[model samples]
Target: MLDQALKNQLAAYLQRVTQPFELVASLDDSQTSREMQELLETIAGLSAHITLRTDGQDARRPSFALQRPGSDHQLRFAGLPLGHEFTSLVLALLWTGGHPPKVEPELIEQIQALDGDFAFEVYMSLSCHNCPDVVQALSLMAILNPKVKTTVIEGGAFKAEVEAREVMAVPMVFLNGEVFGSGRMLLEEIVAKLDTGSAAREAAKLDEKAPYDMLVVGGGPAGAAAAVYAARKGIRTGVAAERMGGQTNDTMAIENYISVLETDGPKFAAAIEAQVRHYGVDVMNLQQATALIPAESEGGLVQVKLANGATLKARSVVLSTGARWRNVNVPGEQEYKNKGVAYCPHCDGPLFKGKRVAVIGGGNSGVEAAIDLAGIVAHVTLIEFADQLKADAVLVAKLKSLPNVTIHVNAQTTEITGADGKVNGIKFKDRVSGDEHLVPLEGVFVQIGLVPNTEWLKGTVELSRFGEIVVDAKGHTNVPGVFAAGDCTTVPYKQIVIAAGEGAKAALSAFDHLIRLPAAA
Candidate 1:
């Protein structure tokens, strides 16, 4: 049950609603039924702009047509309001009413009067609760600017689209028909993209450039190492990573990466970046390499074209873009990311010390997080939709050894519940018979499988059936002068050290190719 204060806040938020709707009542419990009436009344009275529509009320038919409440017009909520979706509903009402959220006036002003329509489609896996922040922010922007239409498609449910769009990660944002950003973007940057047409246009212009001797496409450990080594070898090196640090950025801590004892992700990334920069490697941030094709003229160079219309020529290309963590798209998962929800336990576990927590997924990552959190949290509930843990014997053995950790296999999370802007608990359904119940907790960590970021290379590079990039012993691709390394590539063991080592190999291979190029010329 939500606290009285939260009930009041919910009431206030409900007052902002302007559209007719029905709350998709969770049929799982008596407690929910008991509290529904009081909650509904509070929400109805507090909202100045919204009036409730009972079951038999004059509800308008649902359509894609534009329905206006005012010239101050904004979206009104329709459909089931649950978890993070409810927050979106409230924000939509506020935006439609021309009332900005608690954000600064200047920021609000920046979002206003923006021309052009942008649709953001975020592909998220259920195990990745970190993705909701990206969804919520975009949904809020969509509300603030009617020109923007945002949709968050769960990765698991939309397999066709995932394959079609080559969605390999959670929290991947596709803006204006092309992949815009991944992981997360700050509020200011989002505002800038929303408000400034020129800023977006300039960003789209990163594709205009000449060729280089070596181009490392990823910014992870492997890509960084390749860049540094190539720069040292004095091969007109350039790096065109989507973002620096790759999947390592999501890691909470790295205890096993050799010589890095008790290191955090950001710290590790900084070290790699510093080393790469020391060699005078040309680093282009926030630029995505969309396509790689052989040069038209019979030269050793590969032509790399960016989504933003920038083009570059490179003698060799190293593919080190890493994999993305999978997510579960359950209700409330998107609404509470970082507000008591998390993906990487190592990065966020310490914050939950002494608090009750839940970890989803049966993979090695899930078991690892469960074992790690058991030492920190008061209690740990590990939920797996499968019948048993699929992790290694050592990890599972260690997980079983923990007294504080309780495992629930063949159970799926039905919904994430919260009040007052933080995760409070989760509801689960038994996979066999569909019996559902809620468990209260302060946090939920999702640790499912990872998807390699190699879908875009489908026709260009050879990939494993699972979509991992296939590279040879020296990191050379089937295509000459093109190489791959890291989690995105198929060398097995998606560890940081392995990626770094592979990066070094790819750089050396690229150097070898460059050295022989002039003689061939």
Candidate 2:
């Protein structure tokens, strides 16, 4: 299944495999099982020191479990190891084949000290490049400790499981069946969650009435920047966000941010978090802001209610909740999501290199995705629902200049088509011609629009027609002492540097608000 170049790379990687490892694949009379067998056989064929076995009948399903000299933990895969998960499979096999876990003693001690039996269920897409780090981390723990077990479920393979979990994205870690963290997470974060016995224990220690000089909501680059700026002013600042990374974590490649030539979403998000924590900013994660209770007067404490029945108070608040990609919601879209249907082209585009893919929507994002993928993939087909392409003339001309790109306007994406756990094509209908057609493509990128994360802020602060918070040049919202920034606000272009600058302005504005406060009672 691998090309000559890829096989050569694999050979070099497996040269140090001195210990023998066995890949036990549970097979059945199913096509998925057949595909899984082919993938495993290809890997096992690369090294003479490795062995493969097909033992149990799993009906139409297939699973993999690794066994070797040192590891006895039951780390299993209920889904095929492909896409972003292929790396996890390789890393798992390599570790069992005697590649000692490359980790710090402190991290090893933390994993060893984890007391309870924890099951780390990681949902991943085969196409996500960043997912391997998270998956390998948890699996490494299972390999080292007997108390911990890891289950790798390919999010695209198990559509029903993904739906039951209400998962919309990859690298979603469920520690004990509860959503512990999402996006690109760090090892210390896993250990930190394990340190807390239960969510109840974590929530029970919070003081809802404790006031802060500034509370920065949202954990994206904007919110993190605001917290850092506020903290530097020597005021009590707390950052409450649904997830610490925001939408920035969904991006795969970023080169536009100033002073940084290149970076990925996960790395940038981690950098933002590290900076915020380094400044002693109190960060409350996994807490959704449900409503805003405005302060009665100047210098009065404002209450920020959380989804978990907790009300946090702050003298001022900065809203930086980011936006999410608008899904097409067509049939097979939810079912085939991450299997072949994707949202972020920057994140999942590289996975489709040298393969044909489809882009739904023809706005700037769609045109940009087509342009980006054209350079990597072998062919590109762009489908637009509107009568004419809505992208800028320059972008449209650039797209036209690409020989590999094919654009179809006034066409609607009807369904994403595939079988046996993968996407193979798409079904669409023409608005003008009233004709239906199918395009053979391996992946789909939906770039319709961005819906701001401001539903909870309705009627609280002044909002635009699209529900985005109204903010001035200084990030000040309509309400007194309340500020907003990032994609959730009226910022013209939603970019990392733009949001970060807006956040800094909001933080400075908030500090100025604090300085002019009335005398303390």
Candidate 3:
């Protein structure tokens, strides 16, 4: 099941196993089961401390469990964990075999201290870019806490269960048979959810922090760059974000980044975060900024309030909170989110396999989603508000070549209609004809665009009519000591490289402003 190069790599990594472990597999006479057995045997042959057993009685065939004898540490994989989940399998092996995880010491202790029985099941797809993080996080929790158990389920392998649960998205997490969350989630975020009191404890710690010379309000490429640049100036720098990686965590392939050739969004985000941390920036994740209180005087401190009720003060602030997927405001869209409406085609496309779906928009994102879905879904109806597709010529041509894709220009999505709490169809209007039509489908993918996350800064800083932070060439907002950068600003081209460069410029401009400030009292 694995190539020679992959086997050699696995062999090298297996050397880190410090203790004995067993790969207990449940199998039947099926092609997938045979392939899974071959893969398990290949893995077992690499490490002296590993053993393979085929006596597992799990209800799911072609499934396997990794267990350490004489211990309660155990985790299961209910399908061939290849593709994005391959890394998850490797980590589970190492962690179960007594290899230490890379998490912080405090978090490890927190995981071990959790009381009560917790069972987690994460349903994910092989093509999903965000599935690995959730899978790995749950696996780590299961390995660390004796009371916690986790099972990673491949949605494609269990289509009946996915349909019964109405799981239309990837990385849909369930706790004790109830929905926990959907989409990408980090280890810290999961722990925070379970611990409950962790938020208050975290808020207390954040409230005690001293004012920083430069505080960055985000954790995307722009915020990471700003934090790194500010810290390089020998000033105290801090970053507060809802999540460390921002929207990049949900992104898939990124081939346009300069020099790096190619890399996915998660890896790029991690590299930038490591770069920021290397400069000693105090990175605070899972903190949402709710309000911005400007400084009273030129040299005074600016206070940013968080959703947790804790506030952070800084000498200068760089707002690079970035943007999020723009939702279609039509009726039933909100009522049926995750029921049939999805924003990520890569993550949710497999859930709609053999079913009809609609792609709302004709831009690059919309066209790309349609092309990707054409191979999985039965049919794709592309609706556009413009007269022509805004995608590049090559993409448009490729989309046009797809037999199952239908395009409608000058079309506006009116509503997403659903039945029995699940999406059933979509309504659209032909602008020229002034007529409305409905396309019968099981899912609707909205790829309209992005909206800046600058709602908190409203009335405090100058903003464009589109709600973007208005900044000058130097990345300075109208308010002194307040700078903005990245997609959240009035910058043209919302690319990662451009955001990083703007972040650096904003930091330098803040530093320049700092040097000319009046002496503090």
Highest lDDT among the candidates is held by which one?
3
Candidate 2 local lDDT, 224-308, one digit each (tens): 9999999999999999888888887777678999999998777788789889999998888877889999999989988888876
Relative to the unseen true structure, what is the Cα RMSD of model 1?
13.8
RMSD of each: 13.8, 7.6, 1.0
The C-alpha stretches of model 3 lying farther than 4 A from their native spots are none
TM-score of each prediction: 0.58, 0.70, 0.99
Candidate 1 per-residue C-alpha lDDT over 68-182 given as tens digits, one digit per residue, 9 for 90 to 100: 3443222222222334344544555455445557665755666656667776766554434344456567766666667767655555444556556644345667887897876
lDDT of 3 by residue, 1-521 (tens): 88999999999999999999899999999888999999999999999999999999999887999988888876999989999899999999999988999998999999999998899999999999989999999999999998999999999888898889989888999999999999889999999999999999999999999999999999998898899999999999999988877777877888987898888988888888889989899999989999999999879999999999899999999999999999989998999998989999999998999999999988899999999999999999999999999999999999999999999999989999998999999999999999999999999999999999989888999999989999999999988899999999999999888998999999999999999998776
Candidate 2 Cα misplacement greater than 4 A, ranges? 1-127, 140-145, 151-197, 329-332, 346-356, 371-379, 387-398, 401-404, 414-443
Question: For each candidate, what is the lDDT?
Answer: 0.70, 0.82, 0.93
Of 1 and 3, the candidate ahead on lDDT is: 3
Task: Give the distance in Å from residue 389's predicted Cα in candidate 3 to where it truly belongs.
Answer: 1.1
lDDT of 2: 0.82
